[model samples]
Target: MKDLIILWLSGGNDAWWSVLVAMGNPWQVLDLGAVLALIVVGMQIAVATCLPDRLWADDGTNAFFSQLSYLHIFLLMALTALAEEIFFRAAIQSLLVEWLHSVAAGIAVPAAIFAVAQRARPASCASASRAAPATASSWG
Candidate 1:
């Protein structure tokens, strides 16, 4: 997906690309990804039924989705979760753990960062990931 790369990388080969492209145990990745997808999808449905989109989302976000078919939206949401997991858990939070030499500080810093970042607007449904619950807070 061309759009996935652009959205994830924003047109540059920063260290983030290395983070996104790294490989892991096949079964492990599949299992975790599936769990994350399920969580996000469930959260998406809840948000749609419970909250007005205008409360959490902006017109630009609505316009972006308006251009896509249902299948595209589904795929976008799935990819968004995966990409976010890689960025927050696999990279930022892990790095924080090592640098801060404290697991609490590690997860805490990134969790706060994630909450702030998603404050930009209602992000694609929910950023659900069991391994990284902090990012999932946006799972409104």
Candidate 2:
């Protein structure tokens, strides 16, 4: 978690720097707003497209909204994307570019690190799910 947070802050700082360099106006409110808006829209599109049918499929008795509000889900997705982009794309990769002076190396290094970091959670979840039935049968 701490590593992730550090990555995010660094990414945000790098993103700010990149914008400053490209626009020569770091403090431009409009540019900042546009960047944020783009992030949100991108997130929404990704979610809408990637979500499982069980979660978003049309059924006459669909209870998705009742079970989990759209706002809550949106907030979760936004926060995750913001954190990931900031840490992996902005901060770590930017640092790597500065160190190696190679764009491909910079991007690859952080991407690999991010992929490893992300795999931990899902791997653990899968292991736990696989063990669940065995544990239940042992109790019976």
Candidate 3:
């Protein structure tokens, strides 16, 4: 994929596994915290879905995705995840860490960039933040 190409070009091809770890570890068992987090997230989603559209506007994202076939949707989601992990974590973050000589700088700088870029496109970060209000409502 283009992400791998970018990583290779950045001289980070050898560290690709680091980005895979960021994506997630398939071998790791889910801990209590992970299970609890999933439960809380599911509850948040359920509550959010029950809310009226007036409180949480549709924003046409669901409408757009609704038009896609299930296979297309799955592929889109998978490829997007892979691309983001490789480009951001492997390429950009790795480059930043090497250049800045600070692991914290590497993580923080790419995260900020990702946040801004996601806001501009209203796709990645927006989806994650969509659950945020649901979380607040649950606490209230």
Candidate 4:
């Protein structure tokens, strides 16, 4: 639903393809994505360990995901990665090049937007729980 709106916002551009096409290095892209994901998770772990529990994910966010099965989790992960990369990274990377007149701005702006947007709230996430959910994944 939101992906459709974002694609429309990009003036019908299929940036998912364009970004991949322009990048021209599949291995590197995959490696970068993996490294970035690992780094983010590591950082989150560090934050969780070191910081006081001053801030937290909305409890609803935890409850919502907890209800999903392994299949649902897999689907959510795949769809989220694909949809977000296309709209936020691909679309912004190209459009910003033209509008902002700087490659850095193009990359940075969208990256910030993506981060802030994700943190803002998970739509339909379990209702404002501060604690991280239990580790028992649906598959387990």
Q: Which lDDT values do the candidates have, in the order given?
A: 0.71, 0.70, 0.75, 0.72
Error of 1 at 8 (Å): 36
Of the pair 3 and 4, which is ahead by TM-score? 3
Evaluate residue 42 in candidate 2 and report its C-alpha lDDT on the 0 to 100 scale. 100
Q: Model 4 over residues 1-140: C-alpha lDDT tens digits?
A: 24434666788746554554556778856876797799998998999898754455334467788899999999999999999999987787789978989977887889889889888856444443334454435224
The TM-score that candidate 2 achieves is 0.45
TM-score winner, 1 or 2: 1
Worst 10 residues of 3 by lDDT: 24-33
**Which tens-of-lDDT digit does each residue in 1-140 have in candidate 1?**
34335657676555443433453445655765697889998999998899964456342467878999999999987899999999999999999999999977888898998999887744444442333443335646
Q: Weakest 10 consecutive residues, lDDT, candidate 2? A: 53-62
C-alpha displacement of 81 in model 3, angstroms? 1.5
Q: Highest TM-score: which candidate?
A: 3
lDDT digits (tens) for residues 20-132 of candidate 3: 45546444324534766799989999989897665664555788988999999999979999999999999999999999999889999999999987769556656766765
* Candidate 2: regions farther than 4 A off: 1-66, 122-127, 133-140
Who wins the lDDT comparison? 3
Model 3 misplacement above 4 A: 1-37, 121-140
lDDT of 2 at 119: 72
Worst 10 residues of 4 by lDDT: 130-139
Instruction: Give RMSD (Å) of candidate 1 vs. truth.
Output: 15.5
Clash totals, every prediction: 0, 2, 0, 11
